[model samples]
Target: MPQATKSKDGCINQLKIAENHLSGNYQEKRESYDKEEQLMIYLSKGHSPNDKYESYDEILMPIGALLNNTLNYQEKNEVIKEYGLDDEEFKERMRDMCNLGEALELEARQEESKRKDVEHVRNIIDEFHCSLEKAMDILKLTEKERQEIMPYFQA
Candidate 1:
């Protein structure tokens, strides 16, 4: 079997494992071909070969679109041909892109969390008239975080 097929199979197996952990109808039904087909077509509409995604959401949306197609036997082959890549090569490239996307998402989440933490620390200082050290200790903030939030308090 092709590596793409193997990967798809692996993904399915993992999904099955996930389903086992769920308690309800959230487990996907293999018999729901019509619903699955509709979902595939709907997802594919977001991915035109010539279009470029501009924002973070635009970039992230296509990963689901690509993944929906990538798991299908015919669609995956078509995608490989569309990219002019061999099976193994496309697989490697897809893996790299997925990793990069995941890293970017992680960084974005961490930044947002840090911003919220800084705001919370500032609130603690303002509401209680506490020292910066006290706020830092309460929030478990690091020296770097203290330096970053200090300027806002100064102004």
Candidate 2:
């Protein structure tokens, strides 16, 4: 952009343009600063990820450990900072939580898969327990051969 150097009837129009440009830059910087402060606040309180978190949030480890296990939200942040997780434990716990979430998803699938298989196995065990199998075998044998059947004990 070319600079406006002419004094247009004693009016400095270029200064207004320059001021607007600087003002826009300042506003952008201020907005970014405010967002950073908000993220820091949320991290200190063990908050979950924001809807519009950016690069800094990805690198930040948001883990919290409570010594007493009974502190409220505000107090938990102080204790988490006091312990100073060194980030490794923070990352580990986050991974563990992710694993648990995956396990839960598998559990949902397991229920669908094991429905008939589990029921069939249970029915077989119940039918073989103690008297049921013994009575069936006796019925299959002749009356004279029934005396040869031995009693089975329940485990």
Candidate 3:
């Protein structure tokens, strides 16, 4: 079975319990569940199947604890059964999820770097009071790269 379907159901089933535990739904609190679910779905879709979990109880424990604490033991067991991964399989899935997190963080870092580069160029234009062409030349940006960053600088 696809992880997304299982995770979506798991999230929908467990979110209410988590929310209830956290108490009165403030904006950030309410948004966390949606954000978490979206992240799970995004990771599930991106994860490669070949990745295996080697960490045993270390990696899986937090997941099991979250389920057990929020959803309760009986519900947690039922959910595990419904998802149908045995111990080894469940571990592998957990590892894949961890990889998804690493992948997302890497992507975010790369994007942040690109954003900084754009800001540097924008700063050159504003603080130095230079034209875009001059800024591009000063930054040593290729025409294509300059064009790509131009949309962010529109008046």
**Best candidate, TM-score-wise?**
1
Give candidate 1 misplaced runs (Cα > 4 Å). 1-86, 147-154
> Candidate 3 lDDT, tens digit per residue, 1-155?
12344243223222223444566655555655654432231123322223323343333433443232223334444444544544766656655555565677799997796787798888998999998888889988877777778888788
Q: Which candidate comes out best when scored by lDDT? A: 1
* Estimated TM-score for each candidate: 0.44, 0.24, 0.41
Q: What is the lDDT of residue 5 in candidate 1?
A: 39
TM-score of 3: 0.41
- Give the alpha carbon lDDT tens digit for every residue of 64-121 in model 1: 3356433443444454555455477766676666566667779999889778977898
Question: What is the lDDT, from 0 to 100, of the residue 144 in candidate 1?
Answer: 85
* Decreasing lDDT order of the candidates: 1, 3, 2
Candidate 2 structure lDDT = 0.39
The better-scoring model by TM-score among 1 and 3 is 1
Stretches of candidate 3 off by over 4 Å are 1-60, 64-86, 142-148
Cα-lDDT of candidate 3: 0.53
